[model samples]
Target: MDKNDYLKAVDRLNLWAKAYYTDDSPIASDDEYDKLYNAVVQFEKENPDLKLSYSPTNRIGGEVLDEFKKISHIAKMWSMEDIFSDSELVAWILRGDKTDCEFFAEPKFDGASLNLLYENGNLISAATRGDGSVGEDVTNNAKVISSVPLQIDYKDKIEIRGEVVISKDDFELINSERSKNSEPPLANPRNAAAGSLRQLDNSIVKQRKLKFYPWGVGENSLKFNKHSQIMDFVRSLGFLRDDFCKVIKGIDELKIAYKELLSARELKPILMDGMVIRVNDLSKANQLGYTVKFPKFMVAYKFPATEKTAKLIDILLQVGRTGVVTPVGLLDGVLIDGAFVKNVTLHNFDEIDRLNLMKNDFVTVIRSGDVIPKITGVFKDRRDGTQSEIIRPKICPECGNELLDEGVFIKCQNLTCKARVVSSIIYFASKKCMNIDGLGDAIVELLYQKNIIKDIADIYRLDELSFIGLEGFKTKKISNLLLAIDNSKTPNLDKFITSLGIEHIGEVAAKKIAKNYGDKWLELTIEELLSLDGFGEAMALSYLEFMRVNLEKIKELLEFITPKIQNLELKTNIFSGKTVVITGTLSRSRDEFKAQLESYGATISNSVSKKTDFVLYGNEAGSKLEKANKLGVRTIDESEYESLK
Candidate 1:
């Protein structure tokens, strides 16, 4: 309504964008941010000539990295409209009445996407997903990636979409280097590969050893009449395509494959967050054509988020252990898997930018195990744009200290934020922390809310009688709880360090720190911490700051309770130790049979190879059983599995 309002609105959007893009944490709910963004749009709309050119609405994204040459795509790569449930996906399919149509289901890799241009069998160019329509060229760096072929045998021109991913092993190696350099370790492999590809220096990208796997096509000169044929041809030419890609001949088969892939993906080595279904007939694909954005012949079906969706009632900003204020999405209470989920983490400002979400909007949230639930993709079709955009606070919501952007995380400059203290205390008592069984989430919330427990040390002073007035504290339950708390006094060094709830430090980091410091945690100065094998500077600083507050308390607590530390002993083994395979109709359940075999240190393999020691079969055993018999893999029936057990 006024100049101050406009300035504050713009600042909020900018702050959110920076946090989301760089820190992977957001300070506003997507709906809240969207509401504010819509207000900005309305302001510009009401006053024709007063539009801000640098407004978030006009920018394709936050900051376009200047390191790579930008190129506009032949066709804009619009993101898919995700349907989280099978019934929803089936409804979408039923809307299309075309006959003889088949959908090809393939695994969706969790990695960085790349668009490649190949002219006459040689890679002409490559680009990263900078703004969807236009992107920065990284052709030279892409060439060094092992999975990306320099030259293909295909005679015609073709463009392909692939994802750059670092293997689990490579992620470990890269973290080791970061630890040695005293830099903060990368979060996940996907993030690691994305960071490596964006490096200004090609030498750094080369050192990362990223792998590329082909997924979609862009421009192609191939003469194939079917999508499956084109894919097969691409594979023959030595391009790494998804081998699990299934071609269904009819509607029933298509549905079955879709369901099968959905289940199998959970146990797969490479992460598959979703599935892509494409028309098998190439002529039909061309006939269907494209909308302004998405192709009509292809649709990507994403798996349901681990979290539940509910109406976004409101948004709240909570400061983390690092002092970054994160805007969490509050829901109109929904029950998912018997658990009530009322909030979801927004992850940062850029996500807010992409979703344009607003408060009071119905949104989706995902949560798994002990990891905090996060807001996944938003459903934009539900929006009418009346909601306000969320504004990130200029100062820390907890301590009133200005937040600092480390390009990795936002931290509170204040040494004593109550929110951070509570979060740290809660995290320290978590399962991975001291493993204090009775100190559940409900108890932690109670302790924090009651002001009785400000830190981990407070747990040591509390007695069974102290919890007598607690709502759920029955005589027997309180006795068991007290005994568990008493047993936790002798804490393992790793668990003790982990319980401190330091930023970016997990079980692994705690072990590395404990191994170097032993019992003299204070004696292990910042310099000594930075010198350790996996100690990076950012992590070292975070650890030191956390210890500065809790170190003395920890020493005092140890005097009352001696923590039992578990030394993890490592081991090595060769594949020659065990070898096994499966065949026939497994009536006993394949998974159970495999588990039984594996318990004996035997390897269960698919497709009977020369090295297979034995092939367990059952009644109605199909091609695999016959093949195993031919290959002399010592075929046996379901009874043999029972006997082995």
Candidate 2:
């Protein structure tokens, strides 16, 4: 710990940084690195005359720049041609007679691509991909990204190109923080990252946790046979590169690689819209290159658009199982992520106000996979003379019952409302509930209309004659349904409770309550329910009211079915009486971790609150982690979780 340690400290810290950022491996623990970093800082302060441009401290942040200077890329940064379908990919390969071409496929990151300029191994400047040829110099902002190397071992000039992206979890956390500040939520991670890199103050970018990933180079001195080899060389020079990449020969291997890579969509580190397929051999790729705008050697296989512009045809009220009336938007037919979205949920009147939506107004509809489509924003500029303000409903659309206005929500309190009853039955037979596999919403509604099933008790009293005249009911289908219904007669105690469709009592709460009360569920008191970790006064009251109202119906249903309760002899642990909230990307699935923790007597809740005693978090943990820290709640990482067990 002397002046001689200066050189050693700097070298050791940078090497550790490289290991963590580039190699996805850590040579030293975070604390160990911090200790050495602190020592280096102290040494620098003592020896005030000394200076080192490449010091890791320099990467912390720099002076606020007035504006970004333009940087002309040494080599043209070519955008790839995009192919959306298998047919398009095949056409591209066939036209170029590229059946023999070895393909280099990598995940297509949904972020702003950047070109980093380096000479004599020192990263001197970085630029945003403004156009294919020119870009905005964002050197200081780029340096803030830990994954962007400060210096490499290369002797010749190179432009280490990659996309600057925020992880999905971090993006959500950022939006959560923005929500608290009354700022507009970011549309997507790509925009957030692109905006972060353009900030005048690099300190802001540093807080955003931007990561740089090398995909391709603009100008490089190294000689490599394949694109994969160049990627490896760039990674060796300390750029963050991932292994979800492949080198394949011929069209068959290319298709197989694409399928395999696409199947791993959810496992990617950052948000990716698709996969990029490149001609593998570098010299051959160069010869096959350059269309008017894009390189012929590379093409991006884009995933379907998850967000698209659509016109709001009208607004309609849709009542759910709980009788909550939600404003559903009737959208002009639009395709979003492969789903033809004709209707979208505005959620409630509050959301209607938030987006300032109107009939015939153009809006952005978003849908991810099979998740319900929603209108996130309205295009005020797109409004014309024909657009009209939507009239808010004061009554239920289905039953014409007077609605109860409850601040953010409007509800049809009438239990006899057909929509409510149908929804309730559908919810009861959901996979997490009674799990009647053959019973879906459409069938439930048909049964209700036929008057063959009206209540929970009615489901068990049915026979072959019950479904005889129903449309789409073949004998075999009817038999399968009967079997499914019979098999669901003995639902787990928690599942049965969830099937009751009680307000504010989801699977999480039901499971906790069922396990605590077991077979004595009917004996539970309001005060006892209130004692549960997640149950508040309102929830407790709802539980009591439902039990009191449904007591006779429950008794009748009990004759036809059995609710099997868990007999637990829980192993005691530190989490025995603790309320735990899980967040972020974990080594295992969150559900697996939740079940594991529950087995150790932990009460798992969906969100972070003052009541939470522990927050189990992993990589890129969101605002919950920040809230947990602020609340002074104990946080446990994966290693700590293992140790506790």
Candidate 3:
């Protein structure tokens, strides 16, 4: 056979392999594909120079590696903004002017993103999407994937981005085998795929049977007019493509496609959490550009959350770090979104009343974007006369104090509630607060159980000798814990305030309050607090009540810790007391610029409004720049910003 005949045979077999492995729809029998593949391999061996880049012989597995390296991507991989509902999706489409535009829609695979680099048509490197800019090299594991082409049809250097996923059947089979061997079963298909790809042994990855589906081009020498054209080109290069990817003309077609995909989601062999819609025209997408986090040209439409029904066995009252008494519904074990859930948050007493929840009642539990389960609704039809009505608690379950009703929420008025103390200590040592290492929830619970520690102050007083014989606590571990506790004694004011676990006072709010009041924040009156921006009656009242009740405790905590306050008053520059809005992409990261501006006492506002005193514009300024111009805010470029500083 001639070179042309060999090329045709290779393409035919490649398509057949893709159809059977990726699309799960075989066009030819295994024997036929194998016959053509062998013919192409023989031709390639006889005429090595005439061998095509995507010859069927290149599908053989690759060598193992001692360790995975790290590689930088040619282009940054930006995540898409998520839209939850149809209305939000419509709003996003209209924002990009759907009348003159086209869209390419495909399933958003629930798996790890992998970037493949090909040079001279040979696979050179493969990396995991580790933060977009840099990634871990997984070339050996990537080569083991049958769907991942070892050599592509393209000649020049090109980068392709795709997802690595495990089919449900393969996942279950692997788990069953592991169970037979008395090994721990993998969690889910996504986890299994990631774990398999990261294995040091390439043979283990090959055994897992992971698949790849190319969705986008990262960096390419060839230019395409539209995204659909790029997809076609990628498919021609022998890479597995998403079979359902389609081009739509307008919003109506987009809506129809979304509905179709949603309906077919259950039939898909791999997990798909949502559908990704991108602007079809590449030039238009470039013009639309991106924000600090996501591109404006595309949006992900998430499917409705998975839910399961479980019988409410009992209701447990739990105290949070803020002393709020929350109702937790204990349920019979049920699977939802691949995880077994036996409890769901009722949120408050109002939610229990809203659902009219009763013991033994069947409730619908939902696991949306959060790990915690929530009871969305009750199945009234399934409830029998044996079910008992839910009763509101009259006292705190931990401290035996009478609960105080506060409209939608009920609080344990006692600040010394044991559960509240435990939760507060845990929060204080959390990464967002004092960041005490080796202090986890279980350890905090154990300390509380043994009366070794009582409060945040007690954490600082712990001696290494106290943990001498504690389970899992060796001398080195105890020394590390004591060192962490000692290091946590000097927290910044914002972190200290956040560690207090005040209601409605998170890290951001705490930072704002601390910046405005400085060292005198604890001494601020309710009226003074109400005068501050973002402070309302409820928040002001909460602050006043907490300060008044816990003044002595606060003083005692102050004795044990040093709260470092940022002196905003020291900034007497021109930017001081000004509200600034930043637009477009600057040379440095947006976060760095924001921090610099804040250091000079300038407040950063997300949007351009009449109150904005200055607008710092950079390259590719978009709607915010137009808004700033219309509002007549003083605009400056990067050079002007440097001059001002």
CA-lDDT, candidates in order: 0.68, 0.82, 0.82
Please give, for residues 117-187, the per-residue lDDT of candidate 1 as tens digits: 77776677888876678888887677666456555666577778878877666676887898899987776
Worst 10-residue lDDT window for candidate 1 reads 568-577
TM-score of 1: 0.41
For model 2, the superposed segments whose C-alpha errors exceed 4 Å read 1-4, 46-49, 307-645
Q: Candidate 3 — worst ten consecutive residues by lDDT sum?
A: 58-67
List, residue by residue over 82-171, the lDDT tens digit for candidate 2: 676788888989866788888888888888999999888788899988876789999999888999878788879988889998987788
Q: Please identify model 1 stretches exceeding 4 Å from their true place.
A: 1-66, 75-78, 307-645
Per-model TM-score versus the true fold: 0.41, 0.51, 0.63
Candidates arranged by TM-score, highest first? 3, 2, 1
lDDT (tens digit, per residue) of candidate 3 on 355-385: 8889999888887543478988889998679
TM-score for candidate 2, residues paired by index: 0.51
lDDT of 1: 0.68
Cα-based lDDT at residue 126, candidate 3: 89
